[model samples]
Target: METKELLKKVKEIELKTRGLTKQVFSGEYHSAFKGRGMTFSEVKNYQFGDDVRSIDWNVTARFNEPFVKVFEEERELSVFLVLDISGSNNFGTRLKSKKELMLEVAAVLAFSAVANNDKIGAIFTTDQVEKYIPPKKGRSHALMILRELILFKPKHTRTQLDIGLKFFRNIVKKRSICFVISDFYDENDFYDALKIANRKHDMVALRLYDPAEKELPNLGLIKMFDAEQGVVKWVNTGSKKVRDNYTEQYEESQQKLHDIFRRSGVDYASLSTEGKYLMELNKLFLTRSR
Candidate 1:
């Protein structure tokens, strides 16, 4: 992409997503993810209705007056966009590719985090970690993330969400709100890693997919290629047995993903490239609110 074109795309996305954040997601984002914890702000003279447990005994003794330590929730949070950039993301049969949708989703979340005055960062990965943008707060930082998402080219060609989770756990010390945006077609066992990561941080899964991934069109004959592994095969799409087997496999994958998410206790949402992402996001937000 040309520099001028990329700039326009970034500006366009920033305007759209930032506006949505202000209009719909401002309060929901704040409520959905909490801060690290409460921290002491100051000590004030005790008030009648103040919690007795908050009393500052040392301060009270020094001043010979009852004082209470006031603590406030740390409003600033660090949000990590752990994105997958594998070749399978290129196979969307909709308005855009899964890769395109992933970028937009990440951009919206990044803008929302920045709108809430939180630091936003990202990690672009395939089977391995490709890039890491350190957490920072500002429109410039968010734009940088958008630019990276639009132009990033990964050296690897496969998906391993497990590696992404490990990288997140190792680098980030303080608890963060991590969003793993991917199609999640990996065979690697990431359940343990995801469970551990969720224990330490607030982890949410944003699964990007296409409706065709679940159902196949009955074209008489079709040639398919593995996007990541680069293998090609011709299939008799009209055959009932073949269609049934494909449908069974797709259903199993969906069920396993749901079970993994449920067992991990991580909040999750899915975005289909053929569907309205805004509606999906709004539904997820409303569901979370409930």
Candidate 2:
């Protein structure tokens, strides 16, 4: 993309997303993710009906007046977006590719995080750690992330979900809300990593898919290509048996993903390229809030 065009796109996205965050998602986002815990703010003179346990004896002694310690919920939070940039994400039969949708989703979530006064960061990975943007708060920081998403080119084209999670675990010491955005086509054992991360930090998996992945069209005897493996083959889509077997394989993969998420106790949701992402996200936000 040209510099002028990229700047225009970034400004457009910022205008749209910032408005949504301020007007719509900010409240829901805040309510959905709770703070880690409360922290002491200050001490003030005890007022009527104050809790006895909250009284500061030393402060009271020094001031000769009943003083109590005041605490507030630590509202600040850190959000880590574990993004997948494998070659498979570049294919989509719908309005936008999986990579394109990822940029918008990441933008909205990043804005929502900053609107709640939280730090936002992301890891871009494709079979390896491509880049890691440390957590920071502000619209400028969020714009920088969006720019990277729009223009980043990876050195590799394969995926390693576990590698990204392990890096996230090692770098971020504090508990954070981690959103793993990916097609999740890898065969790696991410269960242990997920369990470890979820035990220490809150983790949510956003599975991105295109409708063509679930159902194949009847383009009889057409050529098919695997984006990741770069393999081409011809299949008779007119044959019912062949179509059925292909569908079964797809469903099996979906079920396996579902099972992994269920057993891991991590919140997971799927977004289809042909459908409304915001509606699905709102449902997930409300579900988490409840």
Candidate 3:
């Protein structure tokens, strides 16, 4: 994209996403993902309703009065967006491509983090880690991330999700809320890495999909392209057996993905490219808040 066009696109996304954050996601996000823990704020005179155990004995002795250490919830967080920019994500049969949907969803998340006064960062990956933007706060930083998401071009076309997860684990030492945005279309096993990452940082998987992936239309014989493999093959989509097998494979993959998330104790939501992503995201946030 040209510079002027790219800047315009970034501004548009920022406006839309920032509006959504202010109107919808800000409060829900705050409730869903809390800060690291409570931190000591200051010492105040103990009140009648105050917890008796919270009274600081040293302060009480020095001041000759009961004083309790006041603590506040640390509301700052480092949020990481682990985005998949593999070749398969570029295909969509509906209104927008999977990559486009992913970018919008990620923008919403970035704005939500900004609204909550948290630092936002991203990891762009194909088969390998393409780029890493360290966490930073403010609207400008979020817009910078949006620009990068719009313009980044990966070197590889394959999907090795484990590489991205491991790279995130190695670089991000501080505990963070990591959102893995992808179609989960990899052939490799990333369960162990995902589980380990979840143990240290709160992980949420946002799986993107399109309608065509779940069901194939009977368009007679058609050429199908494997984006990751960079290969094309002719397939008879008119065959009932072929269509049934395709549906079965998709269902099996979905089941396996759900199983992995469940076993890893990670919260996840599937958003269809043709469906209302806001509803799915709201549902996930409500579930997490509870």
Candidate 4:
């Protein structure tokens, strides 16, 4: 894209996502992902409904009156967006590509972090770690990230999600809320790495997919391309056996992905390129909040 066009896109995304963050996601996000813990704020005179356990003995003794320690939730946090920029995300059969949907979802998350006054960062990966943007706070920083997401290109076309997870584990020592955004299309096993990463940080998987991937339509014979492999083949979409096999393979992969998330104790939600992603996100947030 040209500079002017890119800037226009970034600004548009910022406006839409920032508005959504303010109007819909801010409070839900805050409730879903809390800070580390409570910290002492001040000591005040005890009240009838106050918790007796919070009474400060030192302050009470000093003033010869009942005083209670007040504590406030530490609201500051670091949020990381781990993105998959592999070739497969560029495929979508509906209104937009999976990559486009991923970009919008990422923008929403980054804005949500900004609304919460948390530092936001991103790691781009495509079978390898492509780039790492350090966590920072401010609208400018978020816009910079959006720009990168729009213009950045990857050297590799394959997917190895473990590389991204391991890179995050090494660089970000502080515990953070990490959102791994991808289609989870990989031939390698990343379960161990994902589990280890979640051990130190809260990990959430936002899987973006296309409906065509899950079901094959009766479009007769068609040419199918494997984005990651950079290969093409003719597929007989009208054959019932062929369509059934395709659906079965997709289901098996999805089942395996779900099993990994469940066994690793990581939260995840799958969104389709043609469906309402906002609703799915809202459901995920509500589930986490509870």
Error of 2 at 67 (Å): 10
Question: In model 4, where do residues sit more than 4 Å from their true spots?
Answer: 40-71
Error of 1 at 11 (Å): 2.1
- Cα lDDT of model 3 by residue, 1-290, tens digit: 99999999888888887787777775799999998779999999999999998999999999899999998988899999999999999999898999989988999999899888899999999889999999999989998998998988899999998999999999999889999999999899999999999999999999999988898899999999999999999999999999999999999999999999999999999998995898899999989898
lDDT of 2 by residue, 151-195 (tens): 999988888788999999999999899999999998778888888
The local distance difference test score of model 3 is 0.93
lDDT of 4 by residue, 27-135 (tens): 7999999986689999999999999999999989999999999999888999999999999999998988999998889999998888888999999998999999999
Per-prediction TM-score to the true structure, in the order listed: 0.91, 0.89, 0.92, 0.90
TM-score of 1: 0.91
Task: Identify the superior model by TM-score, candidate 1 or candidate 3.
Answer: 3
Count of steric clashes across candidates, in order: 0, 0, 0, 0
Ranking by TM-score: 3, 1, 4, 2
Give the range of the ten consecutive residues with the poorest summed lDDT in model 2.
18-27
Error of 1 at 201 (Å): 0.8
Q: Assess candidate 4 and give its TM-score to the true structure.
A: 0.90
Q: How displaced is residue 97 in candidate 4, in Å?
A: 0.6
What TM-score would candidate 3 get against the native? 0.92
Poorly placed runs, candidate 2 (over 4 Å)? 41-71
Q: Candidate 1: minimum summed lDDT over ten consecutive residues — where?
A: 281-290
